[model samples]
Target chain A: MSFDTKENTPGTVPANGHSDTTPEARPLLIAIAGNPNAGKTTLFNALTGLRQKVANYPGVTVERKEGNWKFDPGRPAARLIDLPGLYSLDATSLDERLAREVLTGRLPGLPKPDLIIAVVDATNLERNLYLVTQLIEYNIPVVIALTMVDLAEKRDLKIDVEKLRSMLRIPVVRVRTREKTGLSEITEAVRGVILEEREADAFWIGNAGIDASQQADEIHLSLSDDEAANRQIFARYKFISDVYQASVGTFDTERANFSEKIDKILTHRFFGLLILIAILLLVFQTIFTWAALPMDLLDQGFGALGETARASMPEGILTDLVVDGIIAGVGGVLVFLPQILLLFLFISILEDTGYMARAAFLLDKLMSRVGLHGKAFLPLMSSFACAIPGIMATRTIENKRDRLATILIAPFMSCSARLPVYALMIAAFFAGQTVFGFISVGAVLMLAMYSLGIAVAIAVAFLLKKTILKSPPPPFVMELPPYRIPNLRTVIQNMLTRAWLFLKRAGTVILAISIILWALMYFPRSQAPVADESTAARVQLENSFAGRLGQTIEPVISPLGYDWKIGVAIIASFAAREVLVSTLSIIYNVGEEENEESPTLIGAIRGAHDSGGAKVWTPLTALSLMVFFVLAMQCMSTLAVVRRETNSWGWPIFMFVYMTVIAYAAAFATFQGGKLLGFS
Target chain B: MEKIKVLTLADVAAGTKAKVLRVSGSGPVPKRLMEMGIVPGVWIRVVKSAPFGDPIEVRLRGYSLAMRRNEAESIEVTE
Candidate 1:
């Protein structure tokens, strides 16, 4: 049977191969489906290196990865869509439902794929084949790409490919994606099937046991939809069992395997929780220690660039905008890249090695107590690096309420963007002080701030679960995939992709926001100029729009131990929390005649005094400000992502209000309480 | 012939093997469990329980799956 060309055209054409005009020259659409941790992504990355587009599916937070793969030279390129990894077509979660719709051509804007490449984990064939059986029911032409065959052999499980092919009546290509072997054979098989244009074999219907056929028919004829579904499911499983019996063999004892030997301690009741905490602590320590050098280099590089721009350009608004607004603002956000990259590196390794699932399993009990699934833990942990990816990672949580709760508390994890604010404040106020003789007081204060964020996040999550976002915790049925040595290429590629996305935002969104803030603080220059440059700078700032706005909000924030300058920094930081540092630098550095480097930005902040000649940034004020940063919903990008993920402004707006109120009250208490305790 | 002892998967002690007699729940949980190869006649073993004894891990079909005890309660098993 020749394939129906009209029904198989992909919605998007390959950008490089658009010149071909013949109907036979149309691109072929192939969708890859598989269970999670099956190396489907590795195969996809091998087939389409750096040529894929990752975007969200319409109206959902699930990522859509599409790329073009050329089977052979001069052959029409086939468009490959990597559908989300799912267990079955039962379609419980939004991602699974979307995968189902795309497979069946029910999702709008996506045509039915001409062929499906079902990536099956050879070691776990019995479970992976469940999805394959469901795919076979769709009657689409399927080419089975068997991955992890070597691993299966190591486990002493031998899978007879030829026997499996004859039994199932389909092509099965053994592939080792990391070594990039057997890929050409898979492509050739796909090309052969597409050219031959064969229909799905009806072997399953005829080869089924007579009893199963009779049962299926009876349910189809007389039963309701749910019963019919159950009957169909039973039939499929029976068929899978028959196929397994014929083509699969095992030689090892059915006892504890290597993974279990490791899991004995990893998943132990007491040790597992301790190990989890230790691992998280190690991750945090690495993020801070490893990222310090690169962060300092990035900071100095931006500072030098700003200095060069100031020395080269003429004294005008353009020079100020370029040096202070664009460089400083974007640099503020970009400086966190080293930490974000390291975070994703650890996350990618954890995921690639299959420990993430075990982590989820270990955390399920604690998470369920807070009305969330264990899967929510990973996404929330990811928020400590940055909330954008953390919000995106929430798609793994199947339950809507749990996912929302995770997304809502994700920003409270004290992301790396808040690092600059805390570092600057602590250096200014708590430097040279030591706790416990050897421990730096600043470091202790930083750790305490981070702990406060986690504590508040847990409390808020509990409150949300009890009130607005209340829902029964969904059953946590997750697979703990066997561990494998993580592929370095895959982990590095993932890190690079995330870093590129972060840099892209820095160049575009953060760049624009910094320019706007700069103009707000730069404009409204007085017609009559003052003689002294520093006096002119102060006068100019007071007359500007941002300055007036900060003064207006001064009364409101004064109770929290913040003056107009801090007030202005808070307002500017709404775009990104780290902008507060750059805002203070620009506000204080203006019209300074000295060009010395030793008296750094911290010294400038420490030297500044209020109108009454009292110190503006006391230890209490600094602590209060850090607390405010830890609690406040300050990042616009996070709000935008939350809006996009939830498909509404309501949740993000509500999040902003609640977080701001909490931050205000907490900071207020710290300042007032500290004053009463004689700290000031 | 001997009568097999029936117990819900939740009541089945860790490290004990049993065959699923029936998946009794009616919603998505049972359907999902069946999809993952937890059906009648499939042999399964309780691998371990979480720290608080809510979610228990099980080994079946050459892979491991972790589910809450309440969800496991729906799976009728016989040793």
Candidate 2:
């Protein structure tokens, strides 16, 4: 019945906790709360290290991260809950609301914390204090985990922790979570607060309970009726001032403030946007260059593994299963993990360093000018990497119109899932021509497709605003946090966590799908016997369930310049996008044979032709296929995520159907247009 | 003096207010405009749209933000 048992810990238990052999004692619950990018996550990771579990909030899509950590040396089996980052207790977005809900015990089955650890960004005190003020009202024992003290000192900001602690009536400790310094002090402070069982200060409730109308009365108890109310309402600020005087110390303020000066340019109407675009372009280029080597290694490694397995086993169903089903299907999805991880790495860094909010600040005007809310930019930007997260990110946007519009246009921004499809086609059709020195024809084609997606998104957004999903624009309220040095540990931890999730999925959903596809193309227990098993195996696949399905669909796709084999590949690829490559590998009898020196995917596609003496994968089919993927929502996982995020099956189904229609129409137009031009 | 139809976010300056008259696109323009807080009844102020008209900057709800210009023309505003 206990969620707080030692079993809640994910990894190894601490050495101190291992010595405890008696019956259970009440474990102290520590809740970490902070403003976004306040190093709350860093401190959580530092405290818990690898002992954590990531789950989804019951009905909502917000990530639930929990871990176990020892507070006191005497009692090392205490529990730790890493709460979501929040700006204020008056929550607006789902993330902030979830944080508040968990803290307030509104979330079902989530326990109330015995002690609260308020992670405050030292460099940004005034803004972060808003949340601290609210948490004090909850009457919980609080220990202020002051973070980014190093940056605060460099910026000429001074903090009198002792004075502030007296004013707020809470234990306060300054720690640099990323540097692994002051951790013991933080733990000691947490232990002190928990063990002491400190009661909330009366002034905290007195200050926090005031409203705008009664502000004056709280401060001046004897003031006249209206003035008395005013004092009551303004009492909160008075309390804050008292706390500021007590706990905080002053330092020399004459030092250079790089953040403000930088923000002046970065948040500027003209210069800021140019920098953002330039950064985006650089990111796109980096994704290609940095990911290429790893991608190639993965492709070769999977091929070699399949080949080795085939060689070790005798020609039988087991060999086919290992080579084609497991290797082909699972490997197809696994190959893209590196590229996805790299993309996530950059996003995590950008977000952690406080540049993400600036990017939004720079894009607000442009979004508003287009009739979209500023909050939509985050999701749209994420869409460039992957639509699933982008769609999930729509929760951050408060306005219904803005959220819907973002969700609708997100898939239009070419995601990493579509990268494999585009890469395959561009390599096959436009091999080695360069538009400029750095930009090749293939790159140009890719850029053009991306450009087209954006253009179409804009047009679609405008049209949709006028016709459907029409609502007045909500006021754009966004918090702009000051920049701080990003914690390297936190960024790496984030990257590793995401990569682990991807690897986990590859073992389950992707593995199952891959095996099913393998069977479809591998079986009906082929009866044909021959001396040479390899040649007979190729003929047996042609008689399999997948082959029959492909043959049935061939007549429809014939004019699209695809053969029965291509048709089969397309069908099998629906489980995932990159499966197209593996499906082609299996269909072309390259499943068990690993030869990098032989014909590559592009070469095979180019050499393929139909009985009519026309090349099957002509430039037209390649173009059509690229356009199809650009417009179509082919990734079922993305749809599932969308449904989970939106909390509605309607949107996912609509997304699937509408996008598929768009894909078909676009591909049809491309093919017929090419035929009329006599290119094919 | 004549009241000009509110030009695109490109034509506006930081800290200036304009009334949204009509969004410029069929469904796409208005849909995007609505999403960005530029609906017909809402008055918008250009905070700092980006340079080269890429991500346009605007202020709403007492905050400043920037977005793409292509995203902006969809909103027809009146100053």
Candidate 3:
């Protein structure tokens, strides 16, 4: 069968040598389909073994991951598509639509799957079978891989595989994916179906060729249940029952899902909230603790590299660009990679363990009070890592208004990139001040920034609820999957995949942006060098493009106590938040040096002064800077993601403008207000 | 009838039936409620309320529905 090139729009390109056309000549198209949390992903990962492409579905935002695997011992290989985890063929969510589209050959560029590998959670058979029975109607070659058998067995449930096979007339393979027990058999069964099967008459393929438009219509029409709709549903259920009994086996057991037990305690009203708070606190603490060593190492390593470059090269513009501009600007941001990865690692753990949903359950009531949904909580929580993924995660929120609101407020959460800037300022300006000798100034400043973020998010959400994109609250209908102990293998794999994505972006987007900034600050040399290293660097920078640009814009930001240096840092940081610290470092000429002798960016800021000998970074200025960073749209990646997520530049542009204005105003207030209160 | 505020199904006593009067919020509320088979004509009965009145289990349209207390508030009901 020839694959329609236009149909596969989600950016999934097959890794195999076969051309886009004529997929039939290459390998069998096998789709692994099942209910969410049914071990489908595990089975796909095991079968494919690393040959996979993660992409999006065309015309929709659902993630599509496809791979190739040799299921049978003698079979060459089968192209496997791991469709989204869907509860039913009746697509409600965007992800479900893509899964259904791929299965039905409606999704462009993707060949209609030749065979269906239905991965069922053996423990939740009856519920999972609802979809499997629907797939059998498609008359495609089908193999049932029973997963989570270990959990089923523990719950005292036993499935008669032979009986089920006879009932369905399809090959049945039982496998425990996490334990890696039934992989070989699953592959063998798939091989048997592909190699040993007769060419099924495509024309006579049961009800499998049901009209797609009609199905979509039916799904749309079944939105409500009056007595009539209720009867219609019962009729559908009857049809399901006939197919279900004909194709599935019987299992009886008191399966007490561990997740349910944990939910009872953990999702308990009081305990659930407490646990959530404690978890967030722990994550915050761990992010600081775990990232410190690697951060220091990266800091020192970059500093040394810069020093080496400076020592080796003759003092010229090229040398200045390499040591002062590039290393200073980019190295500053790169040091935070450890913290970002750790933050994602924690998020991945929660997601894999399925506690994230529970956290949503606990927080939904509190969040909904402010017009946010429970589903929005995960994405908002993820913003603490980075707003780009957090904004992308809004796809989980099905309602358009809810998703938009969530995206709008996500950046307001204190992301890790903002942490370095906060830390530098707090350490520099608020070193030893104590509130009644109980709370340190650093601690208070940190609390204030975090609190400001939350407050701003709430206010914006409230305004959005009342004004733009106004809507009644979306119905909250999230499935609480039976809790399973997170498979460490899967968690680690997912974390690596996500971290790799971040690093890739860092190497590409951040790298390009850093180079451009370096070039901008290296050109248009000053007439002559000044006495001190810092003064010489500053004068030369002011003559450069970035420096000149900053000078032009300095007047607008002067009220907030910022000079051209801070203005340039703000502009550079717009590419990514962590760049703020590094841009400032570069502007201060904190190039490569020995770790012990090299001054930290924090130290440089403490000692900085303008031409008049007045301190450049005072307590008031530091506080104003922190407030600006807290409210500003400093991450271009996040803006780009918002564009993709919203499918418009309008919202992202609006977000950027509104946030910058807020940041500028807040900083102005803090600085001028602090001065009025005699803090300066 | 006092048009008893549609408390979360958890807050309602077991076996008590109530009519959905109106949903409190705007936008996507209808789609959400409709997805749950909670159309205006349907009468729902509280089957069980979890501790702390959250994710209260209710029976309607021949299926068991569990909703958080906040979700329940969106569905204005009359006893």
Candidate 4:
């Protein structure tokens, strides 16, 4: 019946702070609360570093992060929930409301936290403590974990801890996350107050709810809801400013701080853009260069694994199911691991170092001009690696409309999954052709596709904001946190966690559908006899269930300059876009087994002819197919993730329908118009 | 003191310091401004604008905050 006792992760504190009293009362629920960039996450990570689980709150997209706080060795670790960072509890946004609900036990299924670790920054005490004042009003025991003390000290500022403790009537523990000190004080304080019932001196703020209204009457002042809120706001500030003045001392030095100086150039109107472009280019280059080797290794490794399974196991239905269906499917899902990890690695580093906020700040104007939140920038960029993680990243945008807007347009970013399709198309048709002597035709084609995706995404985002998901422009109030050297441990841990989540969620669905597609293409065993395995394989693919489905849909897709074979590959690619390459390879007998980038695939596709002996893959047809892949919602994994993120089937289905219609229309134009212009 | 010309935060050029007169208009912007400590009498300084000249960064309460021009335009201030 315990969720805390079983998980004693390594590197936990040996907590012998106080003697055990409660045997096992369902693990004390402790909540960690603070402002954004106040080192709340650092403290939470310090307490519960590697032992954490991330899940969604019941119906909302707000992430619920929980970990174990092993404060005392004598007692089981307490459950530490990291409440969403907010400025105050005066809930204006849904995120704020959800946070308040969880804090006050108003949220069903989640008990009110037994104690709160109010992480107040030593540097930004005023804004941070404003939340603390609101927190202590709930009558829960509050322990102030003063973070960023080193930074505060470096700035020649000293915080009077004793005075602050007395003024707030709570335990103020000065903890340095960098030095790993003062965490024991936090445990001892929690134990003294919660377990030993050591109440503090009377607090400054009155108890929660209706206090200001009662205080209004105490001074014979009538109040509206707005005025009452204003009084409460001013009262909190009045007390916070008093706490700030009495508890903080500063030097008379007047020099520009290190962070401010860096911000000057990073936010410069001209140089900032150049630097941003340079950083983005470097990140994109690194993603491609670093991920290529691992991706190729995975591809070959899976091929060898399939070959081994075929050789070892008897050539029966189960072997085909295992080697052709399951192994290939699993490998396809796992192949995305490298790019996802690298993307998340860079993202976490930017987020942990606090440069993400600066990036968001720099991009906010352009984003807003298109009616998107600045937070949408990171997620949209992440879509290029894969849209599943990109969709997950959209949770940071608190506004529902904006987040949905970002999600709907994210798939237009030409994800890495579609790269094989584009490469195959370009290599088959546009190879060895160039505009001038400089840029390769293949390179130009790739750039045009990427540019097309970006352009379409921007247009779709603007339209979404102006229509279905419309609202008054979303509020873009973001904090540019002081930059820090990213902690390698935290960054790696975050990257792994995100990559793992992608695998766990998207990976499962992909495996299932991959098996289903395998079945559809495999069933009704072809009894056709041929001169060789290649001929038998090609005949089997032509008579397979998926092949029949492709022939049936020929009328619908033929106008796009696609034949029945292309139809089969396109249909198979609905489960995952990358499968188009392997699917085409199988149907064409270019290889006995599916190898996505087999150099022969290009030649096979280019030399292919229809039933009447006319060329099947003209440059125009290849271009049209690439256009369809660019605009189509071909990946079931993205739809599954969209369902989870939007928490509804409607949005995903709407996304699928609109994208398919657009993709079909655009490809139709490319083919019909090309023939009309005598290109084909 | 000589009469100081009034301006919304949007009108205050970068590198200028101004004390908030009051947060005007209704809806979530002003409410959020209050939570961020943009209430009356607290002096705030505009640090800079973003690359394309928006989302101005302001310093107050020992931290930096960035808000769009629309949000900033609502915060009436006096230099």
Tens digit of per-residue lDDT, candidate 2, span A372-436 = 77678777877887776667667878766778877888889987767777777777787787776
lDDT of 3 by residue, A1-680 (tens): 10122122222323221335554466778899997788888988888888888766776656677887866655567788988787666545677767777876767887777788899877666556656655665556678899877767676656677877765567789897877788888777767666655332221111133443353345446643233223322333444344444544332322234655566677666777788899998997998899989999998888899889999999887887777667765676678778877877888788877778777767776677778887898888878877766776787776788889999999999988888788777777787899988889888889999999999999999898889978776566655666667877678776766666556545566666667777777777677958887677667776889888898999999999999899988887787776666667667777423222234766788888999999888988989998999999887767766777788999999999999898888999999999999988
**What lDDT tens digits, residue by residue, belong to model 4 across residues A1-680?**
00121111111211221123342656778889888778777788888978888877898756788998888888889999988888887755566778777776668887666778889888778888888887765555689999988888888778889999888888899998878899888888988876675532323352123433344455344554454555566667777888788888552223457878997788788887788888888988999999999998998899999999999999898999998888998788788789889999999988888888888998888898889999999999999999999998887787889999999999999999988888878777777887888789999999899998898888989998888999888889988888889888778877987887888888789889988999998887898668998777788888999999999999999999999999999999998898888889888887745454567877788788887999999999999999999999998999999998888999999999999998999999999999999999
Lowest lDDT 10-residue stretch of candidate 3 chain A? A1-10
1 against 3, candidate with superior DockQ: 1
Interface DockQ of each model: 0.68, 0.09, 0.16, 0.62
DockQ score of the complex predicted as candidate 3: 0.16
Candidate 2 CAPRI classification by DockQ: incorrect
Give stretches of model 1 more than 4 Å off.
A1-25, A49-51, A202-221, A251-253, A304-319, A436-438, A504-507, A531-535, A589-600, B1-3
TM-scores, all models, native as reference: 0.91, 0.78, 0.83, 0.93
Q: Put the candidates in lDDT order, highest first.
A: 4, 1, 3, 2
Q: What is the lDDT of candidate 2?
A: 0.67
Task: Give the per-residue lDDT digits (tens) of candidate 1, residues A474-534.
Answer: 8788888888889898798778776676566445767777788778878876666688766
Q: List the residue pairs that clash in candidate 4.
A: A15-A73
Order the numbered candidates by TM-score, best leading: 4, 1, 3, 2
Query: 2 or 4, which is superior by DockQ?
Result: 4
Q: Give the fraction of native contacts in model 3.
A: 0.12
Q: Mark the 10 consecutive residues where model 2 chain A has the least summed lDDT.
A: A1-10
Candidate 2 off by > 4 Å:
A1-25, A149-157, A178-182, A202-235, A245-256, A311-315, A369-379, A382-385, A392-395, A432-440, A463-468, A505-507, A525-538, A588-604, B1-79
